[model samples]
Target: SQTIHQWPATLVQPVGSPLSLECTVEGTSNPNLYWYRQAAGRGLQLLFYSVGIGQISSEVPQNLSASRPQDRQFILSSKKLLLSDSGFYLCAWTNRETIYEQYFGPGTRLTVT
Candidate 1:
């Protein structure tokens, strides 16, 4: 069975501070990884996606960046968080052969003060 894990279920940070969030998957290999942000009462917006190590596709250009250094590890980082960066961050994975569905782990809600 495949499972995903993300840390720091909730975060509060001052505006202009740095941010780092991590996500990892188990029981799968070479899965397509994606980072999505959802504001309160809104749908998810894709931030970044990785098809392989060092290969990331950015869906939006903003105050966020993503990296995949290993097969199952994906990281989201920001140099200086903005007030607009406050939202729920989610990490998801989908099997390369199956694009119809994506599995999301527990998300991290971030508040930029």
Candidate 2:
């Protein structure tokens, strides 16, 4: 079975600190990876996505970036965090065969002060 993992399940940082969040998948190959941010009581916002290694698509212009250095690894980073960046960050994966069925990681809660 495939599984997705996200680290730093919870985080607290100042407004200008750098941020790095990692996500990895197991038991899947060539899966489309996605990054989403959900504000309290708000719907998830697609931040970034990758179809293949070294290919990243930004859904919105923000203070964040994503990279896929390996087949199953996706990283989200921010050079300087903002108060508005505080939210629940989730990583998900899906393959072409099961594109409708996206598997999500446990997610990380970020609090920017």
Candidate 3:
């Protein structure tokens, strides 16, 4: 069985601080990984995605970036946090076998101030 994991279930950061969020999957290989953010009462917005190691695709131009250093590891980082960065950050994964179904992690709630 495949499982996804996200760290720091909740975070509070001051504006202009650096941010790093990690996500990893177990029992999956070469899976497509995704990073998404959902503001209060808003839909999920795709931030970044990776199809393979070191291959990243950004969906929107923002203050964040993502990297896939390993087959099952994905990291999201920001050089400087913004007030608008406060939101629920989610990590998800899907493989060819389950391309239509995405498995999500518990998520990290970031509060920027």
Candidate 4:
């Protein structure tokens, strides 16, 4: 059984401040990981994805960055957050054999003040 975990279910950060969010998966190995952002009443937008360690694909060029240092640990970071960065951040993982279905963890809702 694979499961994912994300921290700081809700966050409030001042504009231009730094941001760091973490996500980890258990019971899986070398799964494809993804970071998505969803605004209020909007669909999700892919931020980044990783096929393996140190191999990341950025879907959008924004103020955020992602890193996969370990097999099951993924991190999202930003040097300077912007007001537009406020949104729901989600972490998802899917087995390579089953790429069509992805499991998402509880998202982190960020509000830039």
TM-score of each: 0.98, 0.98, 0.98, 0.98
Query: What TM-score should be assigned to candidate 4?
Result: 0.98
- Model 1 per-residue lDDT tens digits across residues 17-106: 999999999999999999999999999999999999999999998979999999999999999999999999999999999989899989
* Pairs in clash, predicted candidate 2: none
lDDT of 3 by residue, 1-113 (tens): 88999998999999999999999999989999999999999999999989999999999999899999999999999999999999999999999677999989999999999
Candidate 1 ranges with C-alpha deviation above 4 Å: none
Tens-digit per-residue lDDT, 1-113, candidate 4: 99999988999999989999999999999999999999999999999999999999999998899999999989999999999999999999999999989999999999999
Q: Which ten residues in a row have the lowest lDDT in candidate 3?
A: 95-104
**Model 3 bad stretches (over 4 Å):** none
Tens-digit lDDT string for candidate 2 (1-113): 89999999999999999999999999989999999999999999999999999999999998999999999999999999999999999999999797988889999999999
lDDT of each: 0.96, 0.97, 0.96, 0.95
Clashing pairs in 3: none
lDDT for model 4: 0.95
Tell me the spans in candidate 4 whose CA falls farther than 4 Å from its real position. Answer: none
lDDT of 3 at 34: 98
Clashing residue pairs for model 4: none
Backbone clashes for every candidate come to 0, 0, 0, 0
